[model samples]
Target: MTVGEVMSKDPVSIREDDYMTHARQVIRDNFLRVLPVVDEGNRVLGVLSDQDVLNIRSSKSNVTVRGYIRETPLITPDMDLLRAARELLDAKQHHAPVVSSSLDRSIVGILSDVDLLRHIQPTKRSPASVEEIMTAKVETAYPDDSISRIWDNMLHWDYTGIPVVSHKKEPMGIVTRIDIIKAGYARIGTANMHGRSSGGSMRVEKVMSTPLYSVAPESSISEAIGEILRNDIGRISVTDGGRLVGIADRHDLLRACLEGTGL
Candidate 1:
């Protein structure tokens, strides 16, 4: 498979001069975690992500995309899908901008984790089981865990989502970065009026998403990929006899694809 065959075409881009608010709006509106930044001629300059926004203490209305731009590894349409996936992982990004394979480097598309996983879902290429890529440490939270501490761990470990497990170590719900920002962002000052602080008093079940989406550890990578693509989720919890075993996210998929572990 090649990048051109699976990449999302005509990707939505943020202009270099666009306000940071616009960037945030674009990300939220498109349900995107990352977006490419482009020049006036539609050439990629950098990328913007929700994580970048989350890191900002505060952004002024005039703060342009340039302030938060992050350079990404560029890809070409003719590049091997696995090779492109490798580049993305090495660059610590879930997506990359694809150029025309010409001297001008004009942006033509965007290749993302979801795109690659979508392609892998149909192929028998990934023969590996979920155990190969799943994280064994499996950081988790309880229903009563303080949101402040949970948020700290999430940012510290770069965990996009953490499974909320019961005392018996069974999966209950999941709290994601989006869930925190959504529930806490606008409720900051209102905490005092409500007689409770935002994150400090918020419970896991209060903001966590319920009805977990998951895959068994013995399942094929393709099965896991299918779960991710079909559900439009960032990662799949790896379970064993209904217990949380681990998690397989885009980074795992990139490693699998890079090594050609499944074919």
Candidate 2:
């Protein structure tokens, strides 16, 4: 299969000159992981991810997309699906703009890890367990922790999601970047930047995704993938006897698939 077969065509994009506030709204409204940054002629520039938008302090900020635009591999629609996944992984980005050709940078579509996941199958090689690829040293947030504190932790550690745990370390829920963004609390750590006192008062439990989905350490990679796709979540908790042991995300599963298939 090819990238064009799975990629989202005519993706929502922002002009390089657009303000970060607009970019934040576009991403929040569309639930986009990344927004393609384009020129006036619709040529691809780069992309602004949800993480980038977290840097915005107020809804009235005048920062342009150009400064925050992150360079990503430009994918062509004709590229092999697996190969495109590999390139995106290597670039450490979940989304990439798809152009017609190398010489023509005009974006015709957009590709994402989720797009690739829909077409991926369990590797033909020996199946691996989720434990083999999960990130064990997870940073978690307590339910009582202030959103401001959690937000600071997420930015300081570059974490997409942090599991909210109980005093005993049992997973209760997960707070993610989108969760904060969707709740209109993307400000990295400026609780008083715009006098948004409520932003600092909010608790992790209020913004966290509940009924946390999880997989056992011994579960197959395919099982973990199924849980993620089924729940439409970025990652799942890896638990053993109801205790959080690790976390497995799309990148981990994608890597395992590529390595196992030797793609």
Candidate 3:
């Protein structure tokens, strides 16, 4: 199959002249890691990813979207879908725009790792357990930890969310960037910048999403993939007897698809 077959058509785009803050808000609200940057005529300029926004915040820059544009490998609709997934993986990005042409810059659609997951066809080479693709180096936060600690971890590590655990390291909930941003908006929190408490009212437990979606370490990739799609979540924890062991997200699924392994 080709990229156009599974690509998200008519993707949301932003102008080059738009503000970085606006791009951040757009990403936060849309739950996207990357946004296609286009000209007034819908010509592709480049892409602004979550990394770009994070880098801007870290540097305390005033750069606009235009300044933040990073060169992206051109993706045309006719390319083999697997190749497209590989390109995205090599770029260390979760998605990319499908354009009419590299020189022309008209984006026809977008392809994400999640889109690639839908294309995965199980093969004999596929592994039977989720362990192969799961990320074992998890950065967890405690429920009692201050919200500022969670914010620092996310900022420095680019964690989409951190599993909330107890002193015994048993999973309790999950704290995400969205939750922190919402708290910041409500409390007018300056803790993210100042590295202080959000007036001591906010805690990791307060913002964490409880009753998390999870899977067992020995679960099949097919089963994990099904859960991910069904729940529409970016990631799911891999537990062994109810303790967090690893995480499998869109990237893991993409790896399985491309390798035709770890089903």
Candidate 4:
């Protein structure tokens, strides 16, 4: 399939002159990996990933998106699916702004890893287990752990989600960057009044998402993909006999796809 066949058209985008506060809110609310930055003429300038917004500090001033705009592999609607996916992977970008052409920067659509994963069936090429692609060295959080601590860990390690485990090391819930961006964005005096403060007093259990989504380490890569797509989540916990083992995310799945299909 071609990129145009699966790419999301008229994707959510932000103007170059828009404030970072607004950009951060848009990413938080849309659950987007990257937001296209465009000019007044609707020409693509670049993109702002979730990581970029996570760096936004809750200070007295707000910055415009222009300064934070990042360059990404420019994708065109007519490009091959795998080729486009390769460009994204090569550039270390999860998504990119689809343009009319290399010369014409007019934004056309947006293509993400999720969009391509739906078309490429890795099972058809190679029957690899989730364990082969999962990140074994996983990071986790305890329910009793302070939200402040978890937030610091996520920023330090650049983790989008951290599994919340019980004292017995069993998965209980999950805490994600979005969770912190919502529950802990405010660290000033007003955060105390809002009750969602990221201060040491707030516990991870309070902000962590319950009913953890997980799959067995030995599960097929196809099964892992299904779970991720079903939940519309970035990553899923990998367990072994009810114990937290690893993590399988879109990046891992797509990397496996490229290797398996030799795309």
Sort the predicted structures by lDDT, highest score first: 2, 4, 3, 1
TM-score of structure candidate 2? 0.90
**TM-score list, all predictions:** 0.81, 0.90, 0.86, 0.88
Question: In candidate 1, which residue pairs clash?
Answer: 125-262, 125-263, 127-262
Q: Give the TM-score comparing model 4 with the true structure, all chains together.
A: 0.88
Q: Which parts of model 3 have CA positions greater than 4 angstroms off?
A: 54-62, 182-201, 260-263
Choose the strongest candidate by lDDT.
Answer: 2
Estimate, for each residue in 67-170, the C-alpha lDDT of model 1 and write its tens digit. 78897887999988767776787888887889988476789999988777666433345546989778888889998886666766776687788999988888
Candidate 1 lDDT score relative to the true structure = 0.76
Q: Which sections of candidate 2 miss by over 4 Å?
A: 187-200
State each model's C-alpha RMSD to the native. 3.6, 2.5, 3.3, 2.7
TM-score, structure 3 vs. true: 0.86
Error of 4 at 143 (Å): 0.7
Clash counts for the predictions, in order: 3, 0, 5, 0
- Expressed as tens digits, the lDDT of each residue in 29-68 for candidate 3 is 7767789999999988889877557444422335678888
Stretches of candidate 1 above 4 Å error?
Answer: 59-62, 121-127, 146-149, 180-200, 261-263
| Model 4: per-residue Cα lDDT over 14-125, one tens digit each | 9998998888778877867689999999999999877767566663446888899889897998899888988988888778889999899999999988898888777466
